[model samples]
Target chain A: MKKEQMTPTPLVQAIGLGSAKAGFSHWWLQRLTAIFLIPLGLWFVFSLAGVPDYSAATIQAWLRSGLNAFWLGLFAVTALLHARLGIEVVVEDYVHTRWLEVLIKTLLSLAMASAIALAVFSILSLVRGA
Target chain B: MSQPQTSSRPLSPHLQVYKPQITSTLSILHRLTGLWLAVAAAVLVLWLYGLAFDASLFQALTGFFSGLFGKVLLFSWVLAFNYHLCNGIRHLFWDAGKGFELPKVYRSGYLVLAASLILSVLVWLGSL
Candidate 1:
């Protein structure tokens, strides 16, 4: 009895009738992006605040800096990704209308995809052109 | 296969049935701020287009943001961002299995609110 108590029993394998989706991955990626965005986002706000003016050249020159460009670009990409994931959950949870859910989510994905692509392009253009 | 003739499962009452508490309010606010922030973030990225190929668009956005309506939106965005950030950190701590005690939960909730307000003020001042 003592030996049996000392030895750990194998845990029961669990099963469920849950939706067959990558729920864990979706949750984890949201957290990962959130963690990444914290510093990247803070830097962005501060950097923009520090700018002398709101001129394009000033903005362009700032983007010319290697660190600035890198962090800003990372922030753009990470933020959009996080936003995409966050909105998906919101739609899934609240939008009970099946067709509406699918339609909104599809449109959202397209917009986010194009936005991300444009963000990367803008960052590259700014840094290299500068 | 046949289903049960009568529904035996109990259904939870709608949110309106319960009195609002700090926990429920804050929980909903987190989601609200999160959704609102998503919209703002999308526009911010879209604004980045002004940086690359659309000078006129950039100028227009800049002007629009400097206007009263823009200021209102920006102010709310800052508040939302700060609240979401602080509350998110609180959530992360909870995920790590700490602060589950009732008193601790209430204390942390207040702290999140205060911190969000302070951070929002600071950002607004700094950016001015």
Candidate 2:
């Protein structure tokens, strides 16, 4: 037989085409962040609810407290991560056009990175500015 | 390779074909609220940035939120946040291999909805 006929085509499903090895980490990290956010989220809600005012001084002082600053910062970071992961899945599910999906995902990554960066910076500034 | 014609082939599951169930509706709501929360979180980060960099900006943002429209939006965010949170916990339970029974699933669905409502009310009330 000729060389073209000798080798059979590879099985697509068997090779798992369209599989990104990154899925498990994405899923696992999403869950892990969710777990962390449970306490962080609750603490944030209750603490903010209890705040007497949203005035600059009051908000600043509240965040300036060591534990509050620590937890809020942690919460911000974790929740941002979780949100990015969730958004990625949403895009993957609904975005059918390959290029548009790619573009959106790329933009999402950039935006999420900036958001996380600004969140950290803002939190730090709050604590330090206090 | 030649492409196989698929015009006559049976298509995959579409939203129009399936009757909506509590489980499916809630699942979609979880995703929808998750997206809303992501947007809410970005706004929150922006609020933090305002507070950190410029107190006047923060005050302006706060002023806007004190309005009626803002109040509605803020309340919706609180409800969305609570809904996502409670439903997320339900998802975690399923991940743990529990709460798979149909009756249990329906019970938990209602429970999540009630908890979300109560939590949102308590939060708004507590803030007031």
Candidate 3:
């Protein structure tokens, strides 16, 4: 007896044939951000943990150091990026309404943008010895 | 017309049907850590904003954070940090298209748990 073979659909041929294809970009971004944060997050925690108290000037002093500032900026950016990606996945998975999903995604994007802006501003201020 | 698949009021897998696994604990811990970090970040924002505003406000805020409750919060922060960091590294490996086999998955899961706990303890001991 001869067996029939499976064939790809026209739509599948037009666009790559798989569920894993589309979501991979988002997955990679999330992983990239996570990888970036591994060491930077550790540095942030260790650097801040040593401070005797959370005094304003002490915090400023910590941020003032070049190494600390570098890691702080890295952490800031990676964290905002990671949070946005994670939240986006959650919304995409759970939020079914088209309008609601769009709204949530937009809000998350804005939040991430705001976080980066604030972080950059603070980093610049510290760098300028403000 | 054909009938729809998976539309017979299909039964879904439930917890009781399967034995518990180590990765399940790690998954739950990841969510819990995410939550604790959110709380810590909120407190951190309050501190940063207070410092940005005025010295008096900063003093009031710092006083609270340095207090007993604050210490507890920071402890949890470190715990969450360690857990998330180690588990996140595991996630990174998965993202790289590795560690799909059963033994490797369980092994790495246990390693992540052990490392986070050890690191958290060391940090706590060092801080004291």
lDDT of 1 by residue, B22-99 (tens): 998999999999999988887787677886888888989899988999989988988898898889889888888999
Q: TM-score chain B for all models.
A: 0.89, 0.87, 0.78
CAPRI quality band, candidate 3: acceptable
Best by TM-score: 2
DockQ value of candidate 2: 0.52
What DockQ results do all the predictions give, each relative to the true complex?
0.38, 0.52, 0.33
lDDT of 3 by residue, B1-128 (tens): 12123344534556677666787878778867865675565455445545555567678877876799978888889999899999888877886789979899999999988999898887877666
For each prediction in turn, the share of the native Cα contacts (below 8 Å between chains A and B) that it retains comes to: 0.58, 0.75, 0.19
lDDT of 2 at B65: 85
* Candidate closer to the true structure by TM-score (higher is better), 2 or 3: 2
| Predicted candidate 2 versus true structure: per-residue lDDT over B25-62, tens digit per residue | 99999999999989888988989999889778888889
Give me the TM-scores for chain A across all models, comma-separated: 0.82, 0.84, 0.81
- Deviation of model 2 at A130, angstroms: 7.3
lDDT string for model 1 (A7-83, tens) is 33222122344554789899989999988877887777667767877788888888887688888878988988989
CAPRI quality level assigned to candidate 2 from its DockQ score: medium
What would the per-residue lDDT of candidate 2 be over residues A15-120, giving only the tens digit for each residue? Answer: 6456657888999999999989888887888788789988888988999876888888889989989999999999998887778999999999999889989989
Q: Which ten residues in a row have the lowest lDDT in candidate 3 chain A?
A: A1-10
lDDT of every predicted structure (CA atoms): 0.84, 0.87, 0.74
Per-residue lDDT value at A20 in model 2: 59
TM-score of 2: 0.88
Model 2, runs deviating above 4 Å = A1-12, A15-20, B1-12
